[model samples]
Target: MKNEVQVKGKFHYRLIGWKYSIWVRLLLFLLLALIFYMSLYVKLVPQVYDIQLGAVSEKTIYAPRQIENAVATEQAKEDAAKRVQPVYRVVNLKNDALIDAIYDKLLQINVDEEVKFDDKVSIYRRVIPQLISELENQSVKTLRNSGQYNDSLLEQIQQGLAEQQYQLPEEAFFKLPRLTKEDLTAMLPVTKDIVSKLMNDQILDAQTARAKVAELVNTSNLTKNTSRELVTEIVRAVITPNKFFDQKGTDDARGQARESVKPVYINKNDVLVNVGDVITEEIYARLDNLELLKDKANHLPQLGLAILAALLSFVVFMFVRQSTLPITYNNSQLVMLILIFLINVAGMKIISLGQNMDYPYIGYLAPMALGSILITILLDAPLAFISSVLFSLMASIIFNTEHMLLFDFRYGLVSLVICFVAVFTIQRASQRATILKAGLMISFFSMLTITAMMLMEDQFSQKEAIMSLSFAAAGGLLTVVFVIGLLPFFEVAFGILSPLKLVELSNPNHPLLRKLLTETPGTYHHSVMVGNLSEAAAESIGADGLLCRVGSYYHDIGKTKRPSYFIENQTNIENPHDRIDPNLSKSIIVAHPRDGVEMLKDFKMPKPIRDIAEQHHGTTLLHFFYHKAVKQAEEEGADNGIREEDFRYPGPKAQSKEAAIVGIADSVEAAVRSLRNPTLEQIDSMVHKIIKSRLDDGQFNECDLTLKELDTIAKTLNETLLGIFHSRIEYPSELASKKTGT
Candidate 1:
């Protein structure tokens, strides 16, 4: 089951390795874009209309822009309506002519000479009633056309005649009164003048015309109330509305007034309404127009933001692709890069939630530099800088409240400055203290940026600015805290030997190094010598010298398990290999590399160190033991089990330049240490021979080292060895003789 699980794990890693390609990377970018789109879509998009009037606002709302301007646009229409004057058409001319016609008919009746006196009076009353009826019918028709006719006036006249008991063939009257020429003549002038004056003036309705007619007759020259009453009835019928309303003109005036109103604008960040204020219809409509309502599903802005996120993702992809860092091209590194970006964005989003609170500046409290520092430590500082830009942009968007589309550059600028400071300060960090120091520098820069931003603002309270500055400083420190906390997890999980970890491992007080020193001092000294040579060679080739140096320290830890068996640690002791069979000696020699790997693993050392320890020998032959075994078997005439392959170190060869360089340095250091009073020429020859032997044996086949780099390493190692094993001058003979004589 254990073996099966191990096989499964291997297969899983193989599948992951296979799937980690350009397509996977593109998909991850797409996923990142999706994350950004989802996070920012709502913040950027216009919302649905969800607010209700007379309800307490669940959250504080700021005007996206000047909304009162739009409201004033609509209010202008109402003001225009109020400004419009009522339109009227002239009907007074027609009314005046009708009055004159009635008066002329009355005069004709009064001056009649063709009838007897008593018959004239009867004839007059009858003719007068008929004439008035015909005239009233004509006047009503005219008034109707002008929309000013009043049938009620005509009805009142008939009712008044009935009240006086005056009856005629006219069925409208209930009764009629006896009439004389004197009564008719007295009323004729008074009624005509009163009707003419009332009609000539503006009379918008029948009621006003009647009131004027009644008042005129009460003060007229008539002696009897009956005569006055009869005149009022006739005049009231003549007094029709002279002014008719003009619908088209009135509408035009109103429209012009509405057009005259200038729009009122509400400024950005202006409070539209208070927390408990009732949402008026005008306010609601304005909010809707501004796309500030929570329930509105305006999608165009969301689409725009999605496009923006995709564009940013594309930029990130292109940036990574163009990066010179090898990790940028590696599948694992790509995964780590995306993971770091997402984590940073997620943290920004969490911090952004506080932006909705009373103290919106709390968003600056987020540790945006966390990812920047991590990127600087785990990857390259340049990539960290780029990531800082992206993170800052995201922070600005996520925290923006004043406007949906407008970026809050205040937060973005601060984040950028702090992140850059963190990355820059930690660029060459080689110890854990460096990260903390970088964080402090980041905090200092952040405070400066915050102060600059506050001073730039036109309106800011000193208390608020100071508080925000403090939060910004704390944000930087928090970033360091997160970076420190997360660094170990990534290192352990990825088996990455970071510079700080390498430095830590190189300490002499380390348990494995201590053990090697006490148990196998010769091997310990040899390892130290190899570390120095490898570090110098790696530096000459522009490789990771620190890693090379540290890897060399633990490369021969396996030999500590059997110190006496190894020639380096066999001080004042006889050779154990001579007493043992040649096959046993070869087995013991080859076991050291494997033993070192196990010991390193048991101590939970990083993979690079274990790899160097295991691959340094790189399947090279234990030539001395192999030849002894072969000669012994040949003498016995049984060389079947003495193949050269059986006496070789089991190795997968060097996989990195550091490992390969350490391997060469390890061999060179051991060979040079074994030499007695070695000359510079001899040391140079020995270093070249060992390198040539390794090259011929194809030990560097799996590594990426070039022949040119190998040549440099050879030259570097030869020079370093010459310095370590240079010949001593015999100059003290004269001094020694002088001291003896004394």
Candidate 2:
């Protein structure tokens, strides 16, 4: 798979560059967009029913002037009861009884109705015939009884029958016997000239003629007929009730006016609203029947909202495209991105739910986080911040008002901030507990944000404040949980060695470490000293000090296999180095690193530690044996037969910061241990000599160790050695007695 990627891909498996893929950018855009969208959708989609949050403020909802009317209604009922005062006291008909009557009326009225406009004439044809016969009778009666047929008398009967008239769409009016205003105005040119521009082809210049009529068409020149017509059109356009408004829908049952019996503070004479009159869908649709453009404009706000979301998505995608982030997203990220897009589109589509729940504002946090966590863990904090900003803008559309927007912005800002806090604060070496701490921090910030929003909204009514505060707490705590839950999966999937994982592996009881302690106590003790020496040296070089210490602890486990053969374990010992050939002894020493790798493998130690134990010695020739062998071989006349290669350990060299530090510490500790009554000069010399020899042998070639860093390492080793093996004034006799078991 890697070979295929390398052969065909542009920047093949760059441990650093996979995060900047266009796919990642696109996913980020979609994820943020979806979060914005879901903020809208969750409100609408969940119950498929509006959770009516009646007007919290005076501005948003229309109020009825029913207080005085209700009082009058009650007074009228009281007057009737007073008329019956001889028998009973006045009764309250405007309370429970009014509610009951309304409920009964509601049962009788089924608005699940399909209004038929086209079949109107056909359905009412029979009534029309009867109405015509009645009108004929009335006309005959006017002519016969009154001794003359007057248009006025005949009009009275038509007026009486008008209440039974069947109304239909104005388009159908063309098929009726109605007189057109043009017919009357055309016959009356004087009136037409005064109120309208009459096109008379006989006039030469149409423009001049229109200008001439325009002057006469001023308000002063309006004839009674034209004035009446003007008033009619104005009334139809403005004063006529919008059919969509159902006045009943505006009835505030809990308003002060409805308290007890009368709506408080409102003057009865000032009342204009009546029962069964309101702004409803019927009123709007009827007005929509007259104004084509106004109806079309109604949907524009929602459409504008959608466009805003898309624009935000574009901006976010562009930002993500330009970023240099650090996470490598998996297929799941793409899946999450797709999910967000779907949710955003769905949310926006059902934005009517905003009346019940602020989906765009309240709903955005979850999906945004779904993307944000991936971004923080895989990429970087800045990208998550960009994503949050983008998501917030997109959310504005979901919430058409600032109140909804506040909540939406808070969710995004907090989510992004929390993601940064979680990712940047906790390293890979951290563990599950860190996630909880992060959650607490997130919670703190969340509560602060909620408090701020509440104070700003000042609906700081206990209920509202508490509700908002709870949501903030939930969001913060949940973010921590989300991060914690996701860490382990990413660590295993990506083979990431976060700081947390390293810390856990550093435990002394780990199987490999335990084996080294039990099997090679002498080597173990040596390793501990080397660990102390190397950790300080590594820290001075700004290397991973923990890795240095841990590596040194397991560097020489192989020597345990033949403890007697090694000098360190020979207590009260024989002079094996004196008795054995120098070549044999050198071979035994060189073989241990190789043997250590085998032991570590058998113990199932991780590969990195095994490499350190095997490669710490590198390919450096043992100078002591080389000189001795050269002397012996030259004497035997076989000088070329004994190659320097056989004397060296078969090594691949220090391949990391820790390995190199271990090697340096190993040589320094041995040299320092060899000192008898050594002065500070000798310790400094030993540290520098060992480092210079390793540098000359090219042991550090594979490792990234600089000269400046090496110098710091030498100084650190010298100081630490002096401290550990420092000479001191003899203790007093009482402490000395304890030391001697006296």
Those runs of model 2 whose alpha carbons end farther than 4 Å from true positions after fitting are: 1-407, 427-432, 474-482, 563-566, 573-588, 598-607, 631-637, 727-742
lDDT of the structure predicted as candidate 1? 0.75
lDDT of 2 at 684: 85
569: Cα error in model 1, Å? 0.9
Number of the top TM-score candidate:
1
TM-score against native, each model: 0.63, 0.50
Q: What lDDT would candidate 2 get against the real structure?
A: 0.53
TM value for model 2: 0.50
Best by lDDT: 1
| Tens digit of per-residue lDDT, candidate 1, span 1-742 | 2222222212111233423466777788898788778877656765454698656666657764444456566876796688678865554335456556655665564466664556655654566556555655565455556554344433443333233322323321211133456776677778778876776677555666676677778888888876776677666655555455566656767777877776655554567767777788877777777766674466678779989989888887888878766555466776777788877877877776555334568777888888888888888888888889988888887777676346888888888888888888888889999988987887788788888777787588877887787877787778778888889988887667789899999999999999999999999999999999999999999999999999999999999888999888888999988788988788788889899999998999988889889888888988998888778888999945767788888896887888899999988888877776565666778888998999899898877788999999999997777666655311256457777995
TM-score of 1: 0.63
The Cα error of candidate 2 at residue 538, in Å, is 3.3
